[model samples]
Target: MKTNIKILALFLICSISAFAQSSKDAETVLQLSKDKWQWMADKNVDKLKDLFDAKAKFVHMSGTWKTDEELEIIKTGSIWYKEAKVHDSAIEVSGKTAIVWNRITLIAMVRGNEAKTEFTVTEVYQKQKKDWKMLALTFSSVRDTHQIKK
Candidate 1:
């Protein structure tokens, strides 16, 4: 009975440690998301290449594409992010995967046309070795509060 109690206690300790680690990872991933936005605004394709998983999928209001394609677009100055003002965000971590929801106001240029819009972006990240790589990103356009009918 003593041995069984020790084993159970060990298991509980391990579980708690994992939860703490996951919380830390979530915070790191959240900060990485913010850094990614800064990179996008700066058009830093090289840095983006390191952050994004090779198999990453990027979905936007305009279109969807793989990591390589998105890099190409950014490299060619096709879609330029001028600013990303995050209003709120939330993060959830599950083992090796982390999901972040960010509500933001974006100022950008698409095909040389300036656009200012609000979006709720869902970003998925996966732990790889010692680093986290972005696996998927999806954006949904949000209506402005002023635009809602009272």
Candidate 2:
């Protein structure tokens, strides 16, 4: 009976440790996603370039594009991200991959015109080496009241 109790206690400790690590990873990814929005608004392509994976894909209402094209769009002011007001966000971390969902109201300048839209943005990140790199970003139009299920 004592041996069984010890085994159970050890198992609980290991499970708690794993859960704590996953929670930490989720928070890290969430912060990264928030920083990415600010970088986009500032048109800081240098920081974005490092965060985006080499083959990263971005999906927008207008069209879909790859990392280089997306960077070029931001750099050239084709689609200037003015601000992203994040209403809600949720992050899930599993092993080396993390997925974040954010409901945001984005104000942007598109082709010389200012536009505001509500969207749910899904971002996927993968741990590469010691850093996390964004692999995919997709924006879906949604109602202002849309909520991310926790």
Candidate 3:
């Protein structure tokens, strides 16, 4: 009975430690997301590419899906960010796979025009070998003017 109890205690400890590590990793990725936005604002396309998985997919709110190269164009100075703020976010992990949900507001320069937008973004990250890479992202945007007044 004592041996069984010890084994159970060890299992619990290992489980808790894993949960803590996963949360920490998720937080790091979340912060990375913010940093990636900053990189985009600066038009650092090379760095942006590093942030994505080689097989990454990005889905725009308008139902347009893009490859990593296509997404990098935005980071290459095609658009500029006047304001971008991450609102709410959550993470779920299973083994090497992590799914992150992030809510954000963005004011950007697009096609020589300025626009403010809100979005709910879901990103899937995979642990590739020794590093985490963003594999897929899907987001739906809400026009700022259409949002309810608080």
lDDT of 1 by residue, 1-150 (tens): 999999999999999999899989988999999999999999999999999999999999878999999999888879998899988888889989999988889999999899999988889999999999999999889865523221
Candidate 3 TM-score to native:
0.83
Error of 3 at 123 (Å): 1.4
Off by over 4 Å in 1: 145-150
Model 1 residue 99 lDDT score? 91
| Candidate with best TM-score | 2
Residue pairs that clash (backbone atoms under 3 angstroms), model 2: none
> Which one wins on lDDT?
2
Better of 2 and 3 by TM-score: 2
- Model 2 segments beyond 4 Å from truth? none
lDDT of 3 by residue, 6-83 (tens): 999999999999989888887777777778768767777777677788778887644544555546557554557666
Give the per-residue lDDT of model 2 (tens digit) for 1-150. 999999999999999999998998888899999999999999999999999999999999999999999999999999999999999999889899999999999999999999999999999999998899999999999999999999
Error of 1 at 44 (Å): 0.6
Ranking by TM-score: 2, 1, 3
TM-score of each: 0.90, 0.96, 0.83
